[model samples]
Target: MKFIKTVSLAIVGTALAIGGAAAQGKTVKIATEGAYAPWNFTGAGGKLEGFEIDLANDLCARMKIKCEMVAQDWDGIIPALNAKKYDAIMAGMSITDERKKVIDFSVSYANSPNGFLVAKSSPLAKMPGTGEAFSLNSQKEAAEKAIDAVKPVLKGKTIGVQGSTIHAAFADKYFKGTADVREYKTTEQHDLDLAAGRIDAVLADSTAIIGTLEKPEFKDYVMVGPSITGGMLGNGVGVGVRKGDVELKKGFDEAIRAAVADGTITKLSKKWFKIDIAPRS
Candidate 1:
């Protein structure tokens, strides 16, 4: 349904917003995967933390809005968003053409790229060709050449990505025919699978993987691949809002700009990712 029945929304609230703090009459339930670590993920005690969490709270304070963060599984996130289960989405969601048809996007809050990681013991551990950046949209030949180079090694290899995510789209577009793509419900699941040898590799946000690689459990994994953006990746992660509600969208855009200008984003990025991804440029 386009707009959720009140009873349905209530049930969803309890199920997805367990940790959500109750405030006054006005509350904006924000939807997230709650599993895209470093973007937005649950901490050890199962509390929300990451770059998006900091940004969300900062934006809410900037807009003087009463907000609560809710964890929505990746696949049903848009459905939940359209159903009014949440007022906004900030779960490292990219702004793409398909999504724009159903929901509107505020200005992009952050722009990071997709990358591949393999067990350090794997042969393809060192990416064929890499530098600062590359793109499939604008540099088709080079990107395809890179893909071709890795095809032999990656063939039959199981690569895990979050389901219904931009990472999945990227894999399908470039590597699906050449390799087996395994979809997971969350990035953390893929991370676990890669560690357990269930999957040969993982393709996800570099920002997200940095968190996984930090743990002692993932010590043997290495980020080995060209980082990618543009084209299939869309315009980086942004806020997803229902059509209209211009005031809330504008408020978020202004708040993001303010956060960027004042260096809050860099600070948060450094804290979470241990590197500054504030301005992807």
Candidate 2:
């Protein structure tokens, strides 16, 4: 879901663990933005629970390394990783060329499309190509055409997107001048604003939009418009680690491949997202 952010050195806060301290031997402190539900989020009593949380545990077991999961703010997640605040990140981070310059990513573990969320009663609920899908990378013309189809309906609407996300960049590129594209610090923040009627629509990962729709408070909201993937949206979601951490990256890659091969990813994704998001490539 992420776009890009300049790395910062400022220390934010102490990382909070979701699991008990790991046993000795090369503990990998994994950072997660414990707010994006279905992907990762803080559960009851501050316990972390979600797809990535489960996947992290499985991957760690496969790697035979001690794993520590910690909560980190989304905006500074990459910077924190570079700053040594965490050994890796598994917070539904997309593997984009832009991000690869600052950090390395393991082979993609999951892939999902991006879309819009709007009130069921809103006119945008009739957004064109509502259930259709397009890839900006392989279907550039079609994807651009699909985007053009939604522009008129979104022209004067207010759209909310999580800051430092591909959705933010997409909104800026296509909807900023015509629509009021607002940025929030996290998906939950935007979801709140959307629920409060502060925003006309929200552009985010379809899985995240689905997460919002699962909430009773968000029952009136519906995912609309074409599902978008690839291009600036990123290759797919992967494990983000410091650029120099080749061994760690290699380990994660192997583990993820195994997980995908063995249907671990499929099982976890279905458990959380109700669909298989395992990367096909």
Regions more than 4 Å wrong, model 2: 1-24
TM-score of each: 0.87, 0.91
TM-score of model 2 (CA atoms): 0.91
Predicted structure with the largest lDDT when compared to the true one: 2
lDDT of 1: 0.76
Tens-digit lDDT track of model 2 for 1-281: 54222221222233223222222243568888888998988777677778898898888877766667888888888999899887899999999999999999999999999989999999999999899999999999999999999999998899999999988998899887889999999899999998889999999999998888999998888999999999999999999988777777878899899999999999999999888899996
Residue 25 of model 1 has an lDDT of 38
lDDT tens digits, residues 204-269, model 1?
888887888888998888886777777778876788987876766776788788888998988888
lDDT of 2: 0.86
Q: Score each candidate by Cα lDDT.
A: 0.76, 0.86
Per-model C-alpha RMSD: 6.3, 6.7
